[model samples]
Target: MLDAGLPVRAFFTDRRGGHSAAPYDTLNVALHVDDDPDAVAHNRVVVSEAAGALVTFLEADHGITVARIDEPTPRPPKADVLLTTTPGIALAAIAADCVPLLLNDPQTGAVAAVHSGREGLYRGVVDSAIAAMLDLRPSGAGAAGIRAAIGPAICGACYEVPENLRARVGRRHPVAVASTSWGTPSLDIPRAIETRLTELGVGPVLRHRHCTFEDTRWFSHRRDARTGRHAGVIVCEGPVGVSVPAPEDAAT
Candidate 1:
């Protein structure tokens, strides 16, 4: 787990640590990937156990909707952004090649996990999330004090897209406009995301350089269709107590 540099605890999950088998091999936290439901449950338990907090993971639809988690629940909502100020609960966003963003405001101790895919980014997921985050803060709060982490995802060189699609996204996000290694039009999502964060006044942004499509340690749907998904999780310290067997016990 790489440190997110936020005031709260944060980390990005990879493919090496769960009970899933084959393409979803291990550490697949997503419930809709057609993996064994039992295995997914075990995986979620393991993740929550390790954090000593209740886990609330978003079921992303690649849209800009938001879900507010005041406490841990049996079912997390379907949204692109999950936010909570409650302590002792974790907020997570699952993804394979799409970007999983962990955001936190140290001053307010409010944290959020966001799913920023190409469509969501094009449709303003980042802006929506930041707006919601600010709403949770004081009257004058902005994103200047928010700490953010960008997890592994398909790189620009590997995310080839049609010209019109690139143009559509580029018209708003010029930094997203990119060319693949072989010279086809592509979208450098991570880079574009970092640029957006910088533009938003968020500082000291932490970004992982791993490309999901190029790194076997990370599950990549573009590289291996029907593959599993990993997640970006943020656990805040609070009063709730939740526990279960550790991941090692379930992964085997």
Candidate 2:
């Protein structure tokens, strides 16, 4: 939806559409996973072309770092989430088994992309992103207009966690804890994210129903340790001063 007039254009890419091979298969977008740099670059181009914007990549390390799109220079800031008020620039975060969150303020046209796995979740990426968005667009006027979408991830049924992890997740999102097939505890990352968004007063929360682990169509690092990464991308719609045509028109 990048070309829409809404404040943000956002989408989560699956593993089915790129050029890669073997353990990484195809469409692996992560440069950190030991995938060939050429393949990764090609994959990134595919994502950008699909999103219709030049997506700025962020190095996510399970920490919170806020970035503005208008900045001329890039610094070494590692964060699991990135936010921007500037249009025409898209922000992207990477994930494999983790949860990717896309947020938008339709009124102000600001957006953010977040990568939150168990560690990032523990670090409060959701809370941090909400705080950053609110700070950029203060007052309930802009905050209340925010919309969020929680993308594909490892489902709780397939996401077995150790007792320590389970306990930590339970502390923040008790409802996400569930008994696993082996009778161990697991955490629903998406559920935790949804709860956090509700708590932060996000207007609408849409969830993708696919489980990366169970669905071979998507990449799952937990299921296959050598798998490539997928990206969640969001950008402000269109080039400066140029209106994007309606979807119906584009289809013609």
Candidate 3:
């Protein structure tokens, strides 16, 4: 877990250590997948227990929907990102090959979990999330204090695209257009996101080095079309928060 001085703890879970079978394998956190519902629930329970809090799960639909910490419980909203300031309210987003972006305002104790895939990128979902966080921040202090982390996903070397899709993504962030090992044109989704973050002046961006497509440990939607989903979770923590457990701690 990365501590951003916010009133929460956040971490991205790769595809490992859960109770699902076959293509879903072990650690599939997505309940929407055809995987056993009981297994998904149990996986969430395990994550919540590890965090020492009750986790509030969301069904992500790759749109811009913001949920407040104190709202009447309704069906999961179709949002690519979820934000909250309430302590212990875990804001989560699911992805297989798409990028999961986590943001935390060290001063305001507000956090956001964003699912930015090709469509979400095209729609400027990440920019919207940053703007929303700025709006939620306390007076005077702006988005400068916000720290962000972009977790594992398919890298440009493994992400191929046609010229049209390339042009579309490049229109937003030109750095995405580059060559790959296969001698084909590819889009570096992470680079595009980093460019956007730079444009937004978001502080201290952490990019994970792992690629889901290359690493068998993670669930990749493109690599396994019918595979289960992995989750990136963020939960508000108490003033005296507990330490985040290491990967080995939860390997069992």
All candidates' TM-scores?
0.91, 0.86, 0.87
Tens-place lDDT digits, model 2, residues 91-207: 787788788888876555668888888878877888888888777554653345567778788988889988888998788778778766668889888888887787777756677
Q: Which candidate comes out best when scored by TM-score?
A: 1
| Count of steric clashes across candidates, in order | 2, 1, 0
With candidate 1 superimposed using the best TM-score fit, by how many Å does residue 134's alpha carbon deviate from the native? 1.0
Tell how far residue 251 is off in model 1, in angstroms. 34
For candidate 2, what is the lDDT? Answer: 0.74
lDDT of 2 at 123: 73
Cα deviation of 70, candidate 2, in Å: 2.6
Candidate 2 — which residues are off by over 4 angstroms? 1-7, 71-76, 140-142, 238-252
**What TM-score, to 2 decimals, does candidate 2 have?**
0.86
Ranking by TM-score: 1, 3, 2
Clashing pairs in 1: 18-27, 88-238
61: Cα error in model 2, Å: 1.3
| All-Cα superposition RMSD per candidate | 7.4, 5.5, 5.7
Model 1 lowest lDDT segment of ten: 243-252
lDDT of 3 by residue, 133-191 (tens): 88865565456646677877899999888878888888877888876779887888887
Winning model by lDDT: 1
Q: Global lDDT of each model?
A: 0.82, 0.74, 0.73
| lDDT score of residue 192 within candidate 1 | 84
